[model samples]
Target: MTDLCPRFEGAMGIISKRWVGLILFELLDGTKRFSEMESDLPISGRLLSDRLKMLEKEGIVERHIYSEFPVRIEYSLSEKGTALEPVIQEIQNWANDWVTPENAQKD
Candidate 1:
């Protein structure tokens, strides 16, 4: 059957991946370098790069490069991405209610 909530479906398609939420959560603090994100999320370099690119295309993330000897690049949440904070918080609250520490520990 066709999905009625196309907007939500599209958003879920982008943010429902395993690493996407962690990536966005990291950006919530501030901008971070590619290396910093890799260290924070502990994901492989290739997958992180791919997710960043997808988020950029979706207008939820921005990449900035500084001209330096080593060429530093950093990623930050776009305005659109910041708008998602409330939704993320609500999800967190919902999970807190239903997902007990005991259940979490089992997995």
Candidate 2:
């Protein structure tokens, strides 16, 4: 027997981490500095650093360094990462429908 599901399992594995979704969501707005991400997300600095590294390795996020007094670093979504927007949106829509405040309160 063959598994019917397409093996998006690899891509799923990459984005399924706790902080990864918010990281991608933030990048959708535009590029952001490491400090900006750290401050915006609820994650610890070390965890954010690790997740950013992992996203970079997966080709979903690109990191750039600016030549300045303090040498700032920024992260933005790559082409592949931008492609995830629709998928994320659909997930949000589905959750909105099935996990409404009323529904949650009832449960």
Candidate 3:
């Protein structure tokens, strides 16, 4: 008898944060700016930045800085992050099937 896998726990630690799943889902389509992610998700800028930094550090997300007049920064999924699409999609499907609009959260 031994531990199954610490990697699974590590993954849960990453995705269990409130805004992380949404942020990954948002980035699934393509690259988006910080402002875009902020607007799309209901999370605060500070929290979003923190999550992005964590994901970047984990190699799940990639941040790109473009040299331009104003300087442009964008975020997109790395190969590791892209690999989560199926898992996220299944979660989305489960939510659609199980989470009723009446019981869901909204302001």
Candidate 4:
């Protein structure tokens, strides 16, 4: 058998992290503020901040700042991140088929 491709392994290493995939899935809708994402997801503010920073560093997430009274900040997927939508969709489809509510609860 051929050895695993390093690039593919690297991609999976980032995507397979806890909350990472869900973050991507959520961002697929469009840009969102920190509080918006925090409320929409079940993750804590600190952890979500950490993950967003990591994704920003990896060029998967873009951070935007607006000049406003509250200094609004928003996050959106980069072109690279946008490319993940189809893959995420496929995973969603697979999960819908194989990962039932009961099956998911087992983990």
Q: Check candidate 4 and list the clashing pairs.
A: none
Off by over 4 Å in 3: 1-4
Where model 2 places Cα greater than 4 Å from the true spot, the runs are 4-6, 101-107
**Candidate 4 deviates by what RMSD?**
1.4
Report the number of the highest-TM-score candidate: 4
Rank candidates, lDDT, best first. Answer: 3, 4, 1, 2
Model 1 residue 17 lDDT? 87
3 against 4, candidate with superior TM-score = 4
Error of 1 at 30 (Å): 0.9
User: Each model's TM-score?
Assistant: 0.88, 0.86, 0.92, 0.94
Q: Worst 10-residue stretch by lDDT in candidate 4?
A: 98-107
RMSD of each: 2.3, 3.3, 1.7, 1.4
Provide the clashing-pair count of each candidate structure.
Answer: 0, 0, 0, 0
- Which of candidates 2 and 3 is the stronger one according to lDDT? 3
lDDT of 2 by residue, 7-107 (tens): 57777778788779889988999999999988988889999999999999989999999899899899999998999999888877897878967665331
TM-score of candidate 3 versus the correct structure, residues matched by position: 0.92
Best-to-worst order by TM-score is 4, 3, 1, 2
Question: Alpha carbon lDDT of residue 23, candidate 1?
Answer: 92
With candidate 1 superimposed using the best TM-score fit, by how many Å does residue 8's alpha carbon deviate from the native? 1.5
Tens-digit lDDT track of model 3 for 23-69: 99999989999999999999999999999999999999999999997
Local distance difference test, each candidate: 0.90, 0.87, 0.95, 0.94
